[model samples]
Target: MKLFKLNKTNLNEVEQIPFKLEKDIQSLVEVNVESVFNLKFIQSELSVDKYRIDTLCFDEENNSFVIIEYKKGKSYSVIDQGYTYLQLLLNNKSDFLLVLSQYFNKVLRMEDVDWSQSRIIFVSPSFNSYQKDSVNFKGLPFELWEIKRYSNDTVVLNEHRSNSKESIETLNPTSNSTISQVSKEVKVVDEDFHLSKTNQPLVDKWNELKEEISNLDDVEITPKNDYISLMLNGKTLCYLIFRKNSISLEMNRGNVKPDGSRSKNYFDLDDPKKISKEGSWEWKSGTKGTIYKIPINKTTDLEYLMFLIKQKYKNLSN
Candidate 1:
């Protein structure tokens, strides 16, 4: 992609700055990990058994660990490497937790982490056609990001999206038992999973909201391990979490005050907003997070949910 600087009279083309080395790419990502991907950087050059991971990060959104690898120029199988790192985390969960505990100066317990959400992210200046094609499966827990730097001291990170309905489990029969089992454990959430997790009526209601959100231009539906995220322009606007009793939503907008009083349908915290506050999953909400609990026991609650969704959409689109 080409970037240009616009002045009053003309547009000046910005030159692409090539990465001097893989370390350069890794350093750029490490410094801006939180801003770019909302991942907390744990440590670089993390070695697990025989394989050395380029960067180890924590995903506070799903309460899982993410393994990021940077490739400058190499041909490798994204599927094999992705599953292998997931297998490593699944087999040795304690070690990964220890790294997180040590980095943040706190004790992390095994129960606090969600092992199923473990993922491997591959970052490079570019990828081969085969490398891109290998991760076309919708359920795979791998992310491919293309990073580039410009002469104007700007950087761009674009995530490669896949809409294929294929499942990686199709290849499990011929693969090792660990890969097969891990593949089953670390798959992304889908509509089928949502239907099974909630009743048909609730699923239909959520789908209604999804349809409205999907109608927006440049919007994408990303199924995460715990919630269904609605993203626009590569930024998550909000996410929907299905519970046994009600459907919970966390919006990504800030400066939203407490909406009246707390009710069964809606609730917003009254705490003062602070940028230093931690553990918020939304990219733009900062520390002041807003959550709405829409009761699924009644179908009429869908209208209220839609109102909230539209309000959030309007706030974020600006």
Candidate 2:
């Protein structure tokens, strides 16, 4: 550095002076995590009862959360801090969970969602190869940014990211597994149901619903010969088996009435009335509101869907 003026006699001292290391590395990571991911960071102090954290980010879209910590010194056994944040997060889940579903968008529930699968990233300029190689990072979504001051007024930032371990069950693009075979002994539900094919409004409706619900999980627009089912939040809210223009409207909050009659009961939109929970949706003003208004098989509910899916996973997992 220009600050260190020395002759050849002291040249070795320059290398031993300890590089100052770029300081803006942490800020850059914060910028990307916030502006890119749309996360909010709340500043805090090590309060009387609880320790303080440097930064936290909420992924509202995925109902996933992320905690970030900066290490100015060496990596310590305190690495367990990230895990603690996750447990503390689940403890105060309500504050962050509800913020996920856009109340600004709509009052969808996020209680069924688990936020730990979010992520944790550590930023340090000097994460030695030893430290990086020694950490067992399995099953954790994380990243490391090693920043260095290269030349005059220039900095080098390297981002090493780990793939998210989060997995999902798509329509077994490679398996012969029938739903029946998957949930063989799992108290199967919707066994007699028909899958809805193309032109089914449920397909479109489910697509629209995805944007409205936050922290929504395992959403699959399941279609068979004549039925369409949306699997979300460990629950199959309802299913449709018809090709109706009823859902032409984008936003409809009340229940579409039965008897081909129109009433604002709101119960008409959901069935297996026990699972006929309250969920509101909105489309465009000029679109048709003719969404599918039929009940699913009585047995197919939230808990049951998880049972079936988990069961299916076991076979595939093995």
Candidate 3:
């Protein structure tokens, strides 16, 4: 990657600085772990059984543990190591949470954790073609991030996202028994899961909404176990959960004020009353307040739904 700086009318290329050691990369990341990935730093060089975890973190939003390994060389299989670490977490939940509680001085509960969304992230200067291809499966629970530093003191971190909607369970059916067992426990949910639970009409409406949002700038749809989140620049803009008769929308602009009362005028829309049928205008839970339920039973509801979606898209871009 080439970076340029404007010197009057001419542009000068910035020199690329290669990281000297893996430890240097780890230290840089560990110091600013929360800001980079919104993860709470657990411990570095954590020796779990025979393996040593490079950097362990806790994802507060997803309520899961994220294992991040920094690599300077290319000689590891992402699938094998990723699954192995995931299996280790699954087998020993208490041990992981205990260490976290001790470090942060707070009691971390076992039941509050979401094991299915547990994943491993590999950060390196670059990834080989094989390593990138290994995580091509949509639901592998592994993320590859390439990090680089320049002489200008600017660092770039790029995540290699998969375009495939196919799950690893279907693609890797003939894999080893360990992977198969782990797959059964910690599987990634797709759009099909929501479709199976809801009716055809609601599913059709969701598809329509998804397609419309896909046309917007830098918008990507990621299907989770409970909901489908619309992400812009890796941050969640809107979260949609498929209910029995309607699709619930939750806008994640930021934290809402912690008030016990659920108000009708919660959302700052031009006409909040118009989209009331879409979902409840009242605030719901703590951080995820006001889950607006948009019913797909009528064509008019969809027309009104566009306003809610566009508002969220606009807020995210800003």
Candidate 4:
């Protein structure tokens, strides 16, 4: 079958990619080898012993197999193919995993696999009532998407289905970072302004942070002894781990180092305007390191902080 290649260059401006669902499936299979099973388009004889399948997919992570059959538009017979593939794949676990590992470049240990828990993904533009109603669409890993040709591109997109897939959710959680600023050498607020006799610099920075954070519904700030902590949606976004003589405005302390410091990680504490009164600070015993950490709630930047918290400091993902 001849494919409709999109001549346009930019993928961002275009709402859809000019590629068929099969093409998308190919690219997805090529790149995401580690995450997904291998999808191969095969043509096997419909012999009594050897039942052929449209496409075979094996998942190493779940010790599972999936049969993906593509029907042009909406076909009711896709379910029949799915069930047929299921019966055949159940008898050939070793063959599927062996081919899967070779395709993905990883060794799969499938000594005790339960093929009954396998899935079927029928790819078609639409589904009929009998196909939809009779089959346990929710129970099986079947996904339906509408293929559209818009502005010169034929794109296959996955429809958002909110199912309680505990296993899948635990494997990949939603990350909350925007900017990919994980460079350890990024400028930290190294310069210090001592909080003596109404420091305007300190106050200016503090109010700015307070105003910015207060605007977001997730954030709430209140004084805790000499320090202030920022909470986002009941989760502690950051806190001013204030020590009188050695002040360190630690943002995402869950990822703070052995001794509290971002190691010049070019990220501020949760709020730049929330500059605390730099009463007294010291780097070494008497070095006087008056520093305030200004942190932004950038989803991606808190990787280190998240790491710190997960390792020993706190629990965030849970």
Candidate 5:
């Protein structure tokens, strides 16, 4: 895509700056993975078995490992390489856990990770039609991100979303058994999956909340394993956990006043630790600061919830 600079009424074309080496792209992405993807960087050039992963990252929200590969050439096959890395991860779960334990300076058990949410990400300047089409399946656990740099010292990374709705399992059998095995274990989840967990009334409330939150500037609604995250500029504004009868809203406890007093106009905050004891929801790993929960039901005031959400949005924006 072309970029331009507006000078008064005239548009001046900005030259594209090409990456000198694959490592250049890798370093840029590894350094800014958190702000760009909201993922935690574990290690670079992580070697497991005979394969070397370009970058290793963990999704704190989903408690899953993410494999990132940088490419400067267009001849590589995304499907083959992506599944190969995923297969390696699935087979060597212990090695990944060890790495995670070392990085965080704590011991982590296998059951603590959600392996089904594991996936691979491919970053490059451009992807060939064949490479893009290979990941057209809805069930493929892979993401293609195109990164570009301009001479004006600006860089943009955008995800390539596939429009196809076909599932990879429906295709004819292939010779590679790794693809089949990995596909069986790793599943792709969407908004519908989370919405299906609740009743129609709760779903309607979720839609209403989704619409109102989405109306905020540059807000992104992303569905994870257990909740729908409302994010602004890569920082989570709130987590919406759809329950059978009520939608649980999780936000940072810092949203409260400096004097530790709850706002009279907002819903009462419940301690996340206390709620977790009741088996209401699991506290996600890598969550910093204190968190408070607010349950949204039919009797709950929608305007009050939006009011609290708007405050968080404004805080994150600033």
Candidate 6:
């Protein structure tokens, strides 16, 4: 994508800056990984057996490990490298947990991580059509991102989304054993997977809430393993969990006062029938803010829920 600077009604084209070294891209991304990918940066240059990972990160939202590889050349096969890295992680889980525990200065057990959600991310300035098409299979735990720097000191990172409807399992027989093994362990989750867990009435309610939430400004719905996250500006504004009868809406406690109490500026604090001050899965996953839970049963709940969500949208967007 081309970027232009507006100088008093005149458009000046911004020059693109090429990365001098692969390490340059790694450094920039490592320092800003949280803002860029909403991932916590672990150790860089992590070595597991014979393979060396460029940057290791933890996805708190998914409770999984993310392996990032930086590339400056376009000749390497992304499919091969992506599967190799994933296989390495599956084979050497203890090594990754050791690094994660040491980096966070805490002891994180094996059960604390969701291994099925693990993924590999390859970042480069550009990718060939073959590299792009290699990851086109649905439910493949691999992502390709293009990173570009500009003369205006602005940087852009864009993810390559696949349009294919085929699953990687279709070609597992012809592929190597490593591909089959990794495919069995890592699963890419989507909305349909979550929607399949509930009945049709709850599904309809979820769709209604999803559409209303997406209609809000700059809101993006991201489906995770356990919940559907509503994101604004790369930060999670709330989470929607599908239940047996109703969909639960979880949001961060936004209007807390200095004295450890919350104000009623955003949500209706008196409505215990709809809102609850209970701890949510996000709180258990080490998120730094308080999470509030609200249930959506019918159309009547949406007006109040969106009213609360709109306040959060305004706050986060500002």
Highest-scoring model, TM-score: 6
Q: Could you give candidate 5's per-residue lDDT for residues 197-268 as a string of tens digits?
A: 888988877778777776788888877888888888777788888878878888764434444554323333
The lowest-lDDT stretch of 10 consecutive residues in candidate 6 is 280-289
What does candidate 6's lDDT look like per residue over 118-234, in tens digits? Answer: 998889999999999888988888889999999999999888998798986777785558888887778889888888878788888777877887678778888899888888878
Query: For residues 5-90, could you state the per-residue lDDT of candidate 2 as single tens digits?
Result: 25765632222122443234446556666653356653322121275656666655444566676776774632355445555565
TM-score of each: 0.78, 0.38, 0.82, 0.37, 0.82, 0.87
Per-residue lDDT for 1-318 in model 3, tens only? 788889999999999899999998999999998888779988999988888999999887778889999999999888888889999988888989899789778997888788887888899999999999888987678889999999889998888988887667775586566688788778666777777887777778777877777777888787776788888877777777887776667663333455544333244545465554333233454533444444455354655677777776675566
lDDT of each: 0.74, 0.43, 0.78, 0.43, 0.83, 0.83
> What TM-score does candidate 3 get on C-alpha atoms?
0.82
**Worst window of 10 by summed lDDT in candidate 1:** 271-280
Model 3 shows how many backbone clashes?
5
lDDT minimum window of 10 residues, candidate 3: 276-285
lDDT of 3: 0.78
Residue 255, candidate 3: Cα error in Å is 5.3
The lDDT-based order of candidates, best leading, equals 6, 5, 3, 1, 2, 4
Tens-digit lDDT track of model 1 for 1-318: 889999988999999999999999999899989988889999999998888999999988788888999998867788888888898888888888888899889998988988777888999999988888888876778899998999999988888877798776676676667668797677666756755776666777777776776667877776777777888765676776776555656664333324433222232333232211123233352333444333344354445555656665665576
lDDT of 5: 0.83
Better of 5 and 6 by TM-score: 6
Candidate 4 TM-score to native:
0.37
Which parts of model 3 have CA positions greater than 4 angstroms off? 6-11, 104-109, 165-176, 252-267, 277-304
> Model 2, residue 100: what's the lDDT?
44
Query: In model 4, how large is the Cα lDDT of residue 12?
Result: 40
